[model samples]
Target: MTALQSRIEGHILTPTGFVLGVLTLDAQGRIADISGTPVATAAVRDSGAPIVLPGFIDLHVHGGAGHDIMEGGDAALHVATLHARHGTTSLLATTMTAPQSDLDAAFAAMGPLCKQRAPNAARVLGVHLEGPYISEARLGAQPPFARPASFDEIHRLHAMAPIRLITLAPEVGGNHALIAQLVAEGFKVQLGHTTGSYEQGVAAMRCGATGFTHLFNAMSALHHREPGMVGAALAHAEFAEVIPDLLHVHPGAIHTALRAIPKLYCVTDSTSAAGMPDGDYKLGRHTVTKCMGGVRLADGTLAGSVLSMDQALRNLVDTLGLDLADASRRVSTYAADHMGLQDRGRLAAGAWGDVVVLNRDLALQAVLVEGHAVRLN
Candidate 1:
C-alpha cells in the first residue's frame, strides 16, 4: 500500500536564501513540490514555521556517540543515529589510521550497511579513508600505522567498497601519481597529515588533488616566507574542510581562511566522545581522554572533537559572526558540492526530502532523512 504524502510548512532555506512556504514530499521520499500557497488536501506534518535548512553533510567526521567507525556495523549505525539527533542527515563514515587488516574490517562491515540506509539514521554516503596513507611527521593523533600511498593497496581498498575520499601526503614518493589515479577513479583526493612544502602542495593540486583535510590541523603551516600546504590551499581556492569547534582552529584563522578560500567548509572531526559525557574514548587503536571541552591523547596532543554539527553551525554564526545563509553553505552545500551530490544539500523539487528544523534559538527541533522524521529524544 502507498503511504500518505506529507506537507510541511516552514521558512525553507535554499542555496540563495530562505523561502517561506509549504513543502510536499511524496511517499518515495523525494521532494514533490514546494509552493508558497498551502495545499488544502495534503496532511500537514509540520506547521510551526520552523527554520528548515538542508540536512548537514559532514565529510570528515570520525565517530560520535561512543561508537567509532573502526568498530563497524552497529557502531556505524549508532553514530549515524546520534548525529541525526543533532541534525546531520548524511555523513561519510570516516576511518582512522590503523592496520590494513583493521581498516579492511571496518570498511567490510560498513559496505553492506551503506547499501541499506537505516531509517531515521544519518545516511552513510560512503567511506572516507582518513589514514594509514597519510604523513608521518604531522601524524597528530594518528598511530604509527601511517604509510606512503601504494597503488596496489589503494586498488585493494577500493575493491573492498566505494571509497569516496582518501587523504594522502603529496610529498610522499609516488603519491602524486596516486592522487592523479584516484581522481580519475572518481575519488576526491585530499591532502593532509603532511609535512609537504608549499610548492609540493601546489604541484599536487595541479595533479588533480582537489581538497585539504582539516586545513591547518594536520597539514603544514603558513610561514611568512614559505606558506606550506596552508598557503597552497588558500592560494589555489580549493575546497578545504575545517573543524570549527573553536579548538582545532582559532576564530581569527577561520575568518582568514573564509576570506581566502571561498570553498572552505566546516566539519566536526568528532570522535566517539561526541554526545557523551567527558570520559575516555577510543579513536581507532589509541585511547583518548575527553575533558574540559577537548579530547586529547595521553601526551595532551589534540584528538578528534566532541563537536556536533548543530553546535558547529552555532559556532559559525554566534562565535564567528557568519550570516545564516553563509553558515548554511559551509555546513551543507559546500560539502555536497565537493562530494558531487547534486541531489542533496539543497531543497529542490527533485532532491531528497532531507531537512533539519531549528527553532528561533537555533536549537535542533527535528531532523528528516528521506522525508522520515528522526526521533530526537
Candidate 2:
C-alpha cells in the first residue's frame, strides 16, 4: 500500500489526558513519531491555536446533518460523511425503535457500509441497536409502536448483523436473560428508556449492563425518596454516557454525575436535525421540531439533540467551566474505553492516527482519520 504523510503541530491531546508537543504521522497512517522539532515535510500545518486531540467517537447517534440512519442506503453513508467533516472520526450508526421490517432494512443497508473501506467516511464502528425491545413507559423519543424486544427477536437480529452495542430497559420482560445472553455473546449492554427502580437498575448491572444511555434523559429521574435509575447509575459510577450539551443535561448535574461516576463519557445523542437549521425532521416515525436552542416533539416531549462532539467539548469548557484536559477525557478517552476500542481514541505510537485539530475558538479546523487529512480548508 502506498503510504500517506502529514504532520500536525500544536498541543497534542493524547488519550490519557495529557497535552504533548508535536505529533508526526508516517505515510502508513500510524504515529511515526512526536518531537519538539518539526518534520521536514510540505504536509506540515501549524495547529498552534487549536487543541489537537483524538477525533471524537459517537457510539449512539441516530441521525445528524439532515439524514437518519433508519433511512438507510446511501443516505446513511452520506450523513456519516457529513459527521466526518465535523470531526467525528468514528461512530456507530444507531437505530431507533421501529417496525421489524424497517429495522431489518436498516441493518441490511448498514452491513455493507460497515464492511467497506473508505477514506473520507467516518468509520462505522458497529451497530448500536437502541431498541425494538424496551419499556413503553420511558420510551422517550422512540416510537411507541416499536417498543420492546423479545429474546428470539434479539437472537435473530444478532445472527443477522455483528451487533457491537445495545441499549434496553432492565425492567422490561426477558431483558434480564437477554442482558446475560448479550454479554455472553460479547455485546456491550447499556440501560436506558425505562422506569426501572434503583434495585432493578442494580440488578441489570450485576447481570452485565455496564453503561447508561444518555445519562439523565429518557429514563427515570433521580429522587431522594426513590433514588430511581439515575441514582443507581450514579451509585455504580464505573461507566455511563452523558450528552453534555448543557441542554440535555444541566451543568451542575453533569459535574455531580462526573463526581459520582468513575468514568463518564460524553456523546452528542444528536438527531437528524443536527447540523441543520431549525425545522421539522424525522427521528424514526416521530416528527422532531427544532427551535430556539432546543428540539422537541409536537407533544413538547424533548427529542434527541442538534449538538456535535466538537461543540460538546466546547460546552464542557465554556458552559461547565471544565479544564481542557478534563473535557477531552469525557469526549475521547472515557468513551473509547467504555466501548472497548483500544486501537484508536488516543494519539500514541502504533495506534491509529485518528486526530482532530481545532482552533482556539474550539471550531473544527481539520480532521485526520488514520493519518490522512480527510477534512481541511
Candidate 3:
C-alpha cells in the first residue's frame, strides 16, 4: 500500500463549486483520492468547524502587513508570507505607477523572487502592473509623473519580465493600439484608474481588455444617462474585480455588482499599512494614512484598504448573506479562473493541495500549501 503523506478530513471545496467530504493529499504533494466516505489514514488532520475551503487567490494586491511589494527585496517576500498566513496561497505582487527606471528595477528584482521555490513565499504568479498607462484624471493614488502607455513602452516592459496582467485607462493616449499589442503578446489587460466614457470602455473590452481592476474605486462613477466606465463594467458580466473590504466599494454597490457581473473576484487592494496600527505609510511616491478600518490620503481619498482575504470572505457571508459556496468563489475559484490559473484554485485529484481551514467564526485555523501545513492557529 502507498504511504499516506497528509490527509485533511473536512468539508472539501472543489473549484466547480461544491463542498464534500474527501480524503485529500497523497504522499507526493498531490491530491490522491476524494470519496464521499471518509477513509482511515495515518496522516489525518481535522479542520474542526466552519469548512475547509480552497486557499484564496489575490491577483491584485500591492502589499500587506507593513510592507509594500514596491519596496522590493526580501521585504516583498516577507509581506507575501504575511498574507499567506492570512489564507492567500497564491498572489501576484502588484506595482504602482513609477518612473520608467524605477518600474524596470522593480520588475527585474521580481524575476528571481518569482522563480524561487521557497516554502514561506506565497506562489508569485508574476507581476500585475497597475499603471504607467492609466488616465491622469482618475489616477487616484498613482504617481502623476509616470509616462502613460505608449506602444513602445509597453513592449519594453513586457520584454523586461513576464508581466502576466496589466491595468490601464482605455481613454489614455495610445492605449488602443497598446491594448491590442499586449493581447497579441498573451497579456491579460484590465481597465482601471480611468475616467473613460462608457463607449471608450466598451472599445477597450472589444480590444481584449478582459478584466477590471478594483472596480468602483479609481474609475468614473455610474451615471444614469452618461453611464461612464462603471456602467460599462456593470453592463458586462465577464470581468470585474471588487475590493470587498466594504471600504473600496460600499456594501450596497458590491451587492449590486455581484448580481450584475457574471464573473467577479475579490481583492484586498491592501496597502503597506495593513496588519499594522492605524498610521502613515507610502504607496510608491504618495503618502497614505490608515484610520478607522480604511486607508486614505490627506485629502480623504480612499488609498487602498487594510483588508485580508479571510476577513473579506467572512464579510461576504455575514454582511452580504452569501453562502460559503458562493463566497468561496469570489476569493478563490473565481479569481483563479479569471487569471487562467488551472491547478491551484481547486481541491481535487491532481490539483495542488492548497487549502484553508477556517473555523465557525471565519477565522483561519490552518493553511496547507502544496500539501504541507504552513499556517496553524
- Best by TM-score, which number? 1
Give lDDT per model, in order: 0.85, 0.80, 0.79
lDDT of 3 by residue, 106-215 (tens): 77777776775457546777889898788887888887854567666666766665678899887877787678878887889999999899999899998989899998
Clashing pairs in 2: 4-27, 50-358, 132-148, 133-148, 133-149, 134-148
Prediction 2 global C-alpha lDDT: 0.80
- Candidate 2's TM-score reads 0.92
Per-residue lDDT over 176-278 for candidate 1, one digit per residue giving the tens place of the 0 to 100 score:
7777777887889989999998999999988898899999898889998989999998889559999999999999999999999888998999999999999
Each prediction's number of clashing residue pairs: 0, 6, 0
Better of 1 and 3 by TM-score: 1
TM-score for all predictions?
A: 0.94, 0.92, 0.92
Q: What's the lDDT for residue 62 in model 1? A: 83
Error of 3 at 255 (Å): 1.0
Q: Best candidate, lDDT-wise?
A: 1
lDDT for 57 in candidate 1 is 90
* Collision pairs in model 1: none
Candidate 2 deviant stretches above 4 angstroms: 1-3, 15-20, 37-49
